[model samples]
Target: MSIQNSIETKVKEGFLALYNTEIPTVEFQATRKEFEGDITVVVFPLLRYKKGNPVQIGEDLGKYIVENVTEITNYNVVKGFLNLVIDDSFYTNFFNAIYSDATYGFVSPKADEKAVMVEYSSPNTNKPLHLGHVRNNLLGYSVAEIIKAAGKKVYKTQIINDRGIHICKSMLAWEKFAPNGSDGQKETPENTGLKGDKLVGNYYVKFDQEYKKEIAQLIAEGKTEDEAKKEAPLFVEAQQMLLKWEAGDAEVVALWKEMNSWVYKGFEVTYKSMGVDFDTLYYESNTYLLGKDVVAQGLEKGVFYKKEDGSVWCDLTEDGLDEKIVLRSDGTAVYMTQDIGTAIQRVKDYADVGGMVYTVGNEQDYHFQVLFLILKKLGFDWAKQLHHLSYGMVDLPSGKMKSREGTVVDADDLMDEMTATAKEISEELGKLDGYSDKEKNELYETIGLGALKYFILKVDPKKRILFDPKSSVDFQGNTGPFIQYTYARIQSIIRKADFDYSQPLTIELHEKEKELLKQLELYPETVQQAAANYSPAIIANYTYDLVKEFNSFYQNVHILGEQDLNKKVFRVQLSKKVAETIKSAFLLLGIQVPERM
Candidate 1:
């Protein structure tokens, strides 16, 4: 049993024996730094069970606990808090127990446990992934890793928005404007020598620009803005193209497939560059018509109602939300309709999936709320297990991004920029004296990517972030490079330890060493907490704290300079364990630690 668990048990037993009162629960906190203790017992809560001065009750309980618990040597009562000082042997034994555990904080999934499906990076095929998608992918990927570490089977998935009017707009623009190749064929990724996604994305922007120009021309000729927008030739043609693609018009469908294939190829490169992956994929083209039949069934069962214009909707006014449209008046499916079908299809595909997490931005908070309610109304048992990992938008220091204007920070470009920044900073610091150019380049990428992922993941998901790349790469304070540097320092220590240090030795601990061990002990619980809350920030902050504690120990104590061989061996062992723990924690955050930085 953990020392905290033992203390709780003994505290309850001590309370019952002394006051003849049975306290149902015990509340504990980290002992205050000013206090000489490792753990603190809040004695104020027990006042309700047995009325008395809190200080007196604390003193009595502390005395009882120290006498009964072997690990706890002494205690002090200040106000209602009982600070218990634990023996050094407790920490030493704890270190010995976990020293060899390579996967110390991770738990394996049980075969019978239900799997969780996490959906992220649901990007439109019209544009390359941007800064916003970067945040979404990082958050989703890290959360999935943390959940898997906490002992759950997790499936990473995404639903690509590969259809609809937006897609057709790009298609129409490309057809009308793309320059022909020398072979007399229209521009393609191969002929143009541009990334398929970027090439297609340029067309999406072109469509918007032309559509706006048409709208302006019609307005100049005396038409209302809304009428001009609806009547614009580019938009009208895009809408017709959508209908053609839906109806399986051979030429349009072929064009759609070819263009979408290009976008998919481009997306593969970006996802690889960003270091995120999916276990399964869903395309909107395949799933857009999914929930229509379910809507019909829901209508018959009174779960939904049809309007006078033949539109289907789920009236959620009674459930504290506005009425939500499921199908359009012309019997076409809306986004909500497609979502309902796609969700059911996923469960059919993965029978063991008991729950799903949708990693969407906070803008769709209400949409998810309505979707979840409608699913519950339709009576799916797994509906209750649905979660929306709603997060705030990511804004750049310059301003917000606009994809249609082609002003967004592209994911690939952002990653490349980060790598460049790392290279510049590393060179300026002059830290790579003996490294070859190839090794230096690889290390720069690792530091660059690590800095990017860490800076984004360290923030609370619901809070907006204004990311600055230079600040994230600084090798000081809460940044990733600082932690990475510490890990590299430990590796240097391990390399220099010529003598064997694998043997675990029982020694009287330094204050810094005991604190480091305490920090290490929190890793398992930290993983569980991060998974439960669906927040990577918890794990990130915990890792930063652990690094800070290790730094203090390194500064105040001598590892190799110690006269006592036992002290040197124990310190080396402690330092290696701390590094191992740092790497493990960082892996959950989707950040890599370089052995040398």
Candidate 2:
């Protein structure tokens, strides 16, 4: 049993024996820094069972704990808090047990545990992934890793929004504006020497620009702006194309396949650059009509109602939400319909998956709420396990981004800029020595991407982020590069310790060493907590705290310079373990730690 568990049991036993009454449970917390203890037990709650002064009760319990608990060397009572100072041997033994464990804090999935499916980066094929998608991808990927570390089978997946009017807009723009060559073929990613997604995205913007001009022209001819928008020639053609493609028009379907193929290739490049991958894939083209039959069954079961106009709706008014449309009046599937069908299809594909997490932005908060509710109303037992990982938008100092205007920070471009910034900063610091150009470039990438992922993951998902690329790559404070640099520093130390340091020794611990051990001990619980909350921010902040504690220990203790062999070996072992834990925690956050920086 852990020392804390033993202390709790003894405290309960001591209370029952002394007060002649039993307390149901015990409350424990990390002892305050101002107090001289490792753990604090609140004595105020004990008064409910037996009325007495909190300070006297604390003193009595402190005395009983020290007398009964061998690992607890001393105790102090400050009003309602009973602070217990544990013996150094407990920490020494704990360190010894976990010293050589490379995967110390990670747990393995049990045989019978149900799997979790995490959906992220469900980007539309019309554009390349942007800064907003970066946050979504990072959060989703990190959460999946944390859940896996916390002992659950995890599947990372995404559903591509590969159909609809938005995609048609790009295709129509390409057909209308694409330049022909001597061979009589229009521009392609190959001919244009551009990424497929970027090439397609340029046309999406082109469609918007031309549509706006047409709207202006119609308004000049005395039509209302609303009417002009609907009457715009480019938009009308795009809509017609969507209909034709839906009806299996060969030409339009061929164009969609070719364009989407290009976009898929480009998407794969960006996803690889960002270091994220999916276990399974779904496309809107395939899943768009999925929920139609289910909607029919729901109508029969009275879970939904059809309007006189032939539209299908779910009446959620009694549940405090307005009626939501599952199918359009023209019998076309809505996004909700596709989502419903796709969710059911996923369960069919993976029977072991008991739950799913949709990593979508907060703009779709109402949409997901309605979707989950309707699914539950449709009587899927697994619907209870569904979660929407809604997160706030990521904005830059320059202001908000618009994809149609071509102003959004492209994900590939943003990553390149981060790498450049890292290169610039590292050169200014002039730390590179005896390193080839290739090694330096790789290190810069590690620092840059690590900085980007860490800065975003460290923030709570519910809060909006104002990301500044420059600040995120800094080598000080609670940043990713700072932690990476510390890891590298430990590596330098490990390399210097040429002597054998593997032997376990029982010695009186330094104050800094004990504090570091306490931080190290929190890693396993922190991973579980991060998984429970579906937030990488928990693991990120915990890692920062651990690094800070290790730094304090390094500054105050002598390792390689120590004359005593036992002390030197123990400190080196402690430093190595701390580095391993940092790497493990950063792995959960999808950040890489460099061996040298």
Candidate 3:
């Protein structure tokens, strides 16, 4: 239950004395800054049921609420909107209730019973994870956490792209150039040798460069351009190698397994550093082929058709989407085919009532549009439950990150650079100068990751982001370190206070304390909205706002060492509640706050 629920209950009791039946949920919304009220009851949604004009019904409800509801000490009607001023004593009681309990700022009664499946971080084995993947992972992970906090059972899953022509290109490069991790310059801490994805990414580059060279030479020898590119043995070999691996050739399978494992090892470290973990892992190597059978079934059932070239396709033209191919002419599954199969597999494997996939890219909006349409056409009613949590791209100061130009922000490298940069900044601020190597490492990583996640998640999901690396890395303004610092400062104050805040509240708080508490009071509602809309940025924005408000309150007001005992006690309790609330919000966003950061 929430404060609004209690207010509504009292309003209903008054209305019941005057009417016959029950009132619906109250129209509770936060008031505008100009309105000298705590909440604005937009009773427009209820006027129809009252058998009167909007203004008349608004007046009746306003009187009914104020006369019976103790929470609203005074209220008035303005432009048919009921603006209610909550009693200052309500703040005193709110603190009293919160001081003895930890779960202060959330709704208790949960809605419905279905599960939410959140899919994210669907990276490929052929290349290193980039800044784009990092944003995707953070948003996806944070969304899952927020949904869970909203009292929904959420399943976090990752679909790894472990097979296909891309995977084989790297394998082929490794086979010819540096077989079995013995390139005579294998990766070591001191050496510049790359990890699995980077190593494989290098080969992907090599394959492209070498293939282009081979084509140029062939065209020079009088072969046609198309023929020169087509007959290039490197691509042909790579394709053949994929076919061989798909056919379960022992050596090819072994090499594929070896490469993907190395990639996993590298990815795991990054995931841990970012403080995210998946509940389930689905490999495309396994699911992509399975999708082929689903496509075949769909074709047989008239949900799809065979093109002139014998490729499997679905006509989504009715939905303004183009005809999409599910399988190649060679009877191999394409991206769509594999995805259809994976959807069915997850539904069966997890027994999930529904799913919410967070891919976090604007480019694939068309792809998911096709994906969900195809699933519905296949007669899976649960297809309606599928969602594409598409987020915008992370552009740099120059422009969009282009991989071929070698300007893409590699995830592992970005983490390293941010951590080092964080350490440098911390040292300059004298925040981590006397810290030991391990403590410095801890502070650097916590603050670095917090900065990265906040910068990426601060903007609304649909808006394209321009990340000026210089401007985003700063800790002085609306950054992650600022929030963490607020928490640290609160903790510092609490430690120095003579009174214990975990005890029951015994006094009325200050104006700033009451203000911070009011914001904290809406955490549950904020979380529920984020989960309902499938947007983690909402929670990110809320957490940052909460931190900012608390920080402002801390800077202006002295909590510890106050002259008045009541003021001192009140400040200490307020600081304690803010710290607890901040920590909880940070955890919901998959961010960790250093005890001292």
Candidate 4:
């Protein structure tokens, strides 16, 4: 049993035996720095059952614990707190048990565990992914991994917004302005030497530019702003194209398929480069028409009502929200309709999936609230398992990004910038003296991406981030490269150890060694807590703390030069375990660790 559990059990017995009163549980915290103990028990809480001064109560419990528990050798009472000093053998035994464990902090999912589907990076097809989508993807992928480590089955998935008026805007723009028209000069991704998504995205921007000019011209010709917007030739044509595409017009449908295929190809390359993947993919085009029949069913069941204009809505005013429209007057499904259908479709595809997590931006917090409530009102048993992992926006120093104006920070570009920064900093530090060019480049990418992922993942999801690539790649402080360098340092130590250090040994522990072991003991609990909170920042910060403890030990203790063979072996083993824990924690955050830097 863990020392905490042992102490708690013994303390309860002590209270019952001395005061003749039964206490259900005990509260414990890490002993204060100035206190001479390993763990502190707050005695003030037990005063409810035993009538006495807290300090006296603490003294009595401390005496009872030391007399009964073998692991706890000594104790000191400070006010109402009982500081228990555990024996060194406890720390050594704990270290020995986990020192060689390759997967110490992870749990294996049981055979019958229910699965969870995590949805993220649900990007519109009209534009390539930007900084916002980058955050979404990284957060979703990391959460999925953490959940798996916590012993749950997880499926990573995304829904592509492939069909809409926005997509038609890009198609219309390409047909009207491309050099060869749609059939004349085909601007295929391969020939243009651009990513498929980027190629399509250029046309989207072009459409906006021409649409604005037309709107301006119409306004100059004696039209109101709203009238000019609706009458603009480009806007009218795009609307017509959307209608035709929905009707399955042969020519329009063919073009839509061709363009979306290109975007999918480009998205694959980006997802691969970012080191995130999905087990399944859903497209809006296929799922948009769904939920309409469900609306009729809801109306029959009185879960929804028809408006005077024939629109369908769920009256949420009673639930502290305004009325939310599910379908338009013309029988067109709204975005919420598509999401409802997609969620149901996923459960159908994976029967074991009992819950879902939507990794969407905080802007849509209200949308998800309505979505979940609607699902529950529809009477689905699993509706209660739904969660919205709402995160804040990611902005750069240049300010917020707008996709239409082409001012957004592109994901590919940001990644490339990070790599360049990593290379620049690594060269100046002369850390690649003996590495080959290929090895150096690979290390640079690993460090660069690691920094990017870590910098973002380490912050609370509800908090906004102003990301600066330059500062993230720093070799010192709470950055990814700093933690990575410490891992490499430990690797160097292992390489220099000429004798076998894996044998078990018993010896008096140094304060630094005991401190490192204490930090290591928190890894499993950290993983579980991070999973429960659905936050990768917990794991990220825990890793930073562990690295800090290991560094303190490294500076104060000598491994290779120690005269005692047993002591040297134990220290090296401890260092190895610390590196292993770092690698494991980084894995949960979807970041890579370099063996050398």
| Clash totals, every prediction | 0, 0, 0, 1
If scored against the real structure, what TM-score would every candidate get? 0.97, 0.97, 0.88, 0.96
Worst 10 residues of 3 by lDDT: 181-190
- Tens digit of per-residue lDDT, candidate 3, span 1-597: 566887777656655665555777777777676777777877676655566566666667678877777777777777767787877778787777777567655544345656778899988887778888888888888888887888778889899988888889878877777534444554421244556567667777777778888899999999999999888898899989988997899999998988888788778877877778998899877776778778778988998899899987888788888989888899877777777888888888867456656564888888888889888888887888888888888877666675533567888888887778787878888855467888888888888877787888877777778775555568667777778888887777766775554555556556667668778888878888987887767877787788878877877887675778777777777778778888888887777887775
Question: Whole-model Cα lDDT per candidate?
Answer: 0.93, 0.93, 0.77, 0.92
414, model 4: CA deviation in Å? Answer: 0.2
TM for candidate 1 is 0.97
lDDT of 4 by residue, 1-597 (tens): 678889999999999999999999899998988989988999988988988999889989999999999999999999899999999999999988987789898999999988999999999988899999999999999999999999999999998888889999999998888764344466778667789899889999999999999999999999999999999999999999999998899999999999888888988888998999999988888888878888898899888999999999999999999998998999988988877887888899999998999999999999999999999999888899999998999989999898988888999999999999999999999968889999999999999999999999999998999999999999899999999999999999999999998788778999899889889998998999998888999999999999999999989999888999899999999999999999999989888888888
Lowest summed lDDT window (length 10), candidate 2: 180-189
- CA RMSD per model (angstroms): 1.6, 1.8, 3.5, 1.9
Clashing pairs in 4: 180-185
Error of 3 at 194 (Å): 3.9
Off by over 4 Å in 3: 6-36, 42-60, 78-81, 103-112, 179-193, 223-225, 299-301, 305-312, 327-330
Model 3 has an lDDT value of: 0.77
Ranking by TM-score: 1, 2, 4, 3
lDDT of 1: 0.93
